[model samples]
Target: MARVLIIGASKGIGLETVQRALAAGHTVRAFARTPVRLVGADTSRLEVVKGNALKTEDVEAALDRVDVVIQTLGIGLGDMLGPVQLFSKSTRVLLPAMEAKRVRRLIAVTGFGAGDSKSSISFLQYIPFRLVFGRAYDDKDIQEKLIKASSLDWTIARPGILTNGHRLGTYRVLTEPQDWHNGTISRADVADFLVQQITDRSHVRKTPVLVY
Candidate 1:
């Protein structure tokens, strides 16, 4: 199994990915500002590294000798309104670090309204989406552009409305622009896809919308 570095490994999809990847027998370095939550009895192959994703030194340290990188970084709801730079800024730090380490495979979790997927948002839902998630999603747009512009073997998984549901292991991987639409998906299922991408090259250089 490959050694996987999971950024933002404290909670949400990141935490789910850590569990899923470990269950799949991949050694995981769980990076987060406060990853104490990840300490468990069966942490034999898990390495919990507490660090800020925006710090160059911190991110570079987390990228050590990993075969693949899965970035599932997220910010709290409180930071959604103001100017959000976590996604873009950390990505700026991430891409070059990955290059330095020669870790070319990146599985980044950007949501449905990011980049071209913004165009897929319906006219009715567009207003509220703009009102609430506009700022964060805009930064995700920048994040997507940076990844696309890079030479890394990248697969962007744009999951729709997230929920705390169980992993059914069944969801739509919408690769075509016409099939890109928003719907609810479990964080576990998204993690399932992320783990699958560590070896699956079919979606490399492709951004697929995940939905149920």
Candidate 2:
């Protein structure tokens, strides 16, 4: 099993990924600013590191003795209107840390509507996408670009709008921008795909639009 570092493992998809990664038998280093509580998990294999991703030292410290990096960094919907640099700033620090540590694999959770997927967003969701998530997604575009330009074996999982539903264990991964349609997927399912990518090499260097 690989040692995995999840950058935002406090709540949302990041927390779900922690549960899923543990179940997959991977040694997980859970990084978050808030306290993390995992129910019925083996604490020996899971390391909870409380720190913000924005700090270079914190990010660099978390990469120690890790084989793969899975970043699930997110910002609040309310804070999306303000200056949101979590994704891009975190990536800037993380990429160098991973390089310094010689960790080559990175599976980052950048949602749909980022990068070229804007052309594929549905008309029904277009207005809200712009009015609500425009700024954050713009930074995600920068996040994607930085990851793409890096030397790491990267698979950018661009999941659609996420819900807190049960894991279906089924979803479509659209690689082409034109086929990247907007849809709702469970947080557990997105975590499932991210964990699967830890060992699956098929999606390396590909940004697949994950949806149901």
Candidate 3:
């Protein structure tokens, strides 16, 4: 079991990963601004650290002695309309911190529309997606580039439309560019993949799309 530091551990896939990682027997440092929001998290192997992801000092402090880092950072819907920089800004802080701390493995959650996956968006969903998610995905593009350009052993998990469904423990890991497309996946299932990556390096240095 590794000491896994999960960024953005309060809600969504981050919270789900926190739970799943603990259940998997990994020591978890749940890092977030409002980490108390992680209600019912197992305290035995869980170290809840409240800090801002975009802060260099905060991220460096959180990276201490961790074997792997899983970044699931996100912003609220209210901020989606404006120019979004959370993903890129946080990555800018996180990557160097990980390298400095010698945490070589990183499994980051970037959605389907990020990086080359943007080209996989169907024509039908393009207009609305661009209208609503363009700003956010644009920053994710930067985030992907930054991660790719790093020296860390990284696997970028790009799940499609997110849901609050249960973890089925079975999902597709689409590694080929031709297989990349939009679909729906539960946050729990995505976290299942993230926790698995703590020791499973089969997907390292690849950005695979996840779906049911």
The model with the greatest lDDT is 1
User: C-alpha displacement of 155 in model 3, angstroms?
Assistant: 0.6
* Native-to-model Cα distance after best TM-score fit, residue 8 in candidate 2, in Å: 0.3
lDDT tens readout by residue for model 2, 120-145: 88788899888999899889999999
Task: State the displacement of the C-alpha of residue 132, model 3, in Å, after optimal TM-score superposition.
Answer: 0.8
Return the clash pairs for model 2, or none: none
Q: How far is 25's C-alpha from truth in model 1 (Å)?
A: 0.5
By lDDT, rank the candidates, best first: 1, 3, 2
**Candidate 3 backbone collisions, by pair:** none
Clashing pairs in 1: none
Who is ahead in lDDT, 1 or 3? 1
TM-score-better candidate, 2 vs 3 = 3
Better of 2 and 3 by lDDT: 3
Give the CA lDDT, 0 to 100, for residue 87 in model 1. 97
lDDT by residue (tens digit), candidate 3, 1-212: 89999999999999999999988889999998984465576678989899999889999999998999999998778899899999999999999999899989999999998999999999999999999889999999999999999999999999999999999977899999999988999999999999999999899999999998
Which candidate model has the greater lDDT, 1 or 2? Answer: 1
How do the predictions measure up, each by TM-score?
0.97, 0.97, 0.97
Cα RMSD of all models vs. native, in order, equals: 1.2, 1.1, 1.1
TM-score of 2: 0.97
